[model samples]
Target: MEASENWLVESLRLYQDFHAFDLSGATRVLEWIGDKGVFVAGYESLKKNEILHLILPLRLSVKENQGLIPDRDFKVCHGGFSDKPVFDLKHVPETRLLVTSGLPCCSLKVWQITEDSDVIKAVSTLAVPEEGNLWPRLAVFSSMAPGVLHGARLSTLRITDLESQKTAYTSGIGDSEVLSSLQVLGTDTFAFCCTSGRLGLVDIRQKWTPSENISPSPGSGGGRWCADIRNGGQGLGPSIASFCSNGQLCLLDPRDLCHPVSSVQCPVSMPSPDPELLRVTWAPVLDNCLAISGFDGTVQVYDVTCWSGVGSQVEPLFTHRGHIFLDANELDTTPLVTTHIWHPCKPRTLLSAANDASLHVWDWVDLHASS
Candidate 1:
């Protein structure tokens, strides 16, 4: 069993490496644009600037075994000092737009690639609150209105219209909990997870009112750190994948959020060690599979096809350990996984970034074949 696990981990081919900046902090955001490009966001504490990199994989022939290389002239953007900046990209068939917040002397900026030029250009800047943390926990483009963007402020969720450069709607989730993440469900509805271990469903068409609230446990404080809505498939309606600070992954049905359809505990050491979940994203091709990054420097893929109810533990399909541990204790780690993202078009490709200023592009086709 141990030998097979080692082989599976070793079969991950290092396709590319992206280390252009002198960034020391862990990457806070990573997004892939189809199979050709990726966007990485990180903060440099010494320089007090946020770094955004747009990397394109070099086109090579099949006979070339030198590995995938980044373009010689990759694009880089620098923002202001922020612990976590809200960064996301919107890709359509014809247009590609990138939205980011928490820049120095700038609240929100929208960038897009022009048809004539490959360079990214600023298109608009949205309004933001004057006080509180400038970093937004969530920033997502609305599915219904392509020009509209929804982002979370300190305690409120604001929707901005990119075309008009105006605030469309703003609502607060009260003072009890902080908004952790947001996932758009459909045209008019979206779901948000909170630090209070609560899940909320909001309908923008209904005057931005929260229609439902589901509290999984009283005082769980393991707040659902991240939530992602799956792309429907396999006779299943839209469901949610949520990861809590206490290392709990729960699958909840949108219709009945009061109880989770399935729940699983993440692998962690004993003595009540709090494992921080950095990111959670569903596989672009596989409907029943999802990947999660942990603060302990591990990335795990879980298959939820058999997940049916609470108290049922779901084992990870595969575990990838790219970051290294410096000391004997797990608490003292060399580098941690800050962000990880699966390829938008390729099911076997994944990209991960760590605080050690390293980026790895992993191809897991061989591992899947072996399994």
Candidate 2:
């Protein structure tokens, strides 16, 4: 592995209050435990027969930058044979953590975190019988019922009752295409992006089923390799933000799925630009703002509030290249930033992990800050 430049590290010390940690593994899912200063992440362990999760937190230091300390470690298994990275985790409101993973040996596990300490107690566990083998590509908790977990199980959407171990409902997410990402819109509604270049809105209430799905903008050449999907937060109600496979960021209003509010050419990752390497997420504290990663070993934050419908390129408000340092030639070496997320309670604070097993918890000090 290559090292960052001394000059760049020196510059990062100027206004970047950041800390890095070695997770010893790579994870696809990262979720904050509500407003707490802690978060949970999980990934497959090739050496072990199962997956391991870490409840890690950043320790605020007065004398130095914050550092991530491992709080707890837990294991969830019977999913070692999954073909794709299907391990996903989400925090439910009732002190419960919902998790799903597995293919040939499918299983779902729920754990309860006590209010006293980080000790996670196993509340429930269920194994999806081999007869149905409904592998989950994406999973999220149902806002209406804490016991229900909804997942995009390949060809169909499965809303399973974790308490009773029964399939509550099933519907088509897309004609069997892989689901890239899923975001909960409301109690019984969700927005998702499929590998087939389709962004869809599905609601369980009102017996909702759409006859058609929406495609990307016309200028996108009719092919969308959607990498990620997220709901626009704060004041943008019913607003959806999706990073297309074509490297174009799209603003969408779920009320009219067929038409996009705007489409702009977002920056592509350096060295290699692939949809699978890129991810998008909106901030809980900022409006018309979102973060994009897997772009040349850095996370770029942009404010779309100023996006003009002319299809022009929008510049990022902040460019975070802390993951990789420029060589003497000033080019990035480790160019893939695996995943990034915004702090639920802290404004402008970001947590990101890279392919090199480096986890970062950093806050950019805006000289001219905004609310």
Candidate 3:
């Protein structure tokens, strides 16, 4: 394996006096759309609603002699309702649509970013029939169909059309398996991970039949927190990269959902041993590379091009420890890496959010050289 110590890391400030538990009570709420990043945080005081949506332009420029700084050319803040933690944010650049979901609420709000006004305006809001504390863990926008949004609410999955402000389809994943994450596979197909440690694929065109499920080995611990479909140049039909509760990273082909094409263990062990709160995503530009983050407060990147079978073992190409606390005495209080997002256009650029309410941008220098 080739290793390089050439990585540039930058710390970004989101909100003043921000606390992680105040707004969302969780982190994985960062999304990158075009040149802008949308983050959800909570206000410090109780006078206003807790949830605050921050829109930050992510472009960077080098000053004549001031090195590099984010081109703070534009910034916008939108207020949300109280006690509604924004659990997920997704942006569809093609449609200029922004979708957000809050926990304990069944409502999904669709907004449009107006270029002329440099503001986000709500286009429509659709609420699911059910009401619960953990409904709608995440929302995913489909590129195959403009204005079509998919969401997972506890054991149920819902699909809505933003143009009509109506739900197109809804189905329950029986046996009480709560959904943890969602991914769009194709125009009519999508994949979801559940608390039962099973990965399922559903085709919306097929009336949401009994999903084809993949169960991990016995005693491997079931429950997949996050799954992302690979967008490589390879001709594979919608391969999946999933992070499971057993501390396993799995790569599977949705066409053949019975078995995983590759399965490897995560290097950074979770500090709390709770595996149902992690995230995994494929590299936007790399064919077989991906990243995983969890309660470990570290991010790991692995190249699975050589993965062949169940026992296949692949070491991470890079391990990012920038989120770890530098003070030895504060090791016990180290913040977890809530989520990490790859640049939509840049091959080697990645952004990660931590429980400390800070965002870090990591640029892999070696990967850029080879690309």
- The TM-scores of all predictions, comma-separated, are 0.75, 0.76, 0.76
258 Cα displacement, candidate 2 (Å): 2.1
User: Mind giving the per-residue lDDT tens digits that candidate 2 earns over 189-224?
Assistant: 666676555777666664546422545456666444
Q: Which ten residues in a row have the lowest lDDT in candidate 3?
A: 13-22
lDDT of 2 at 277: 53
Question: What is candidate 3's TM-score against the reference?
Answer: 0.76
Model 2 TM-score is: 0.76
What lDDT tens digits, residue by residue, belong to model 1 across residues 157-241?
A: 7677666776776675454355667665666666777655577777777664564454655324544466777765212543777
Please count the clashing residue pairs in each candidate, in the order shown.
1, 1, 3
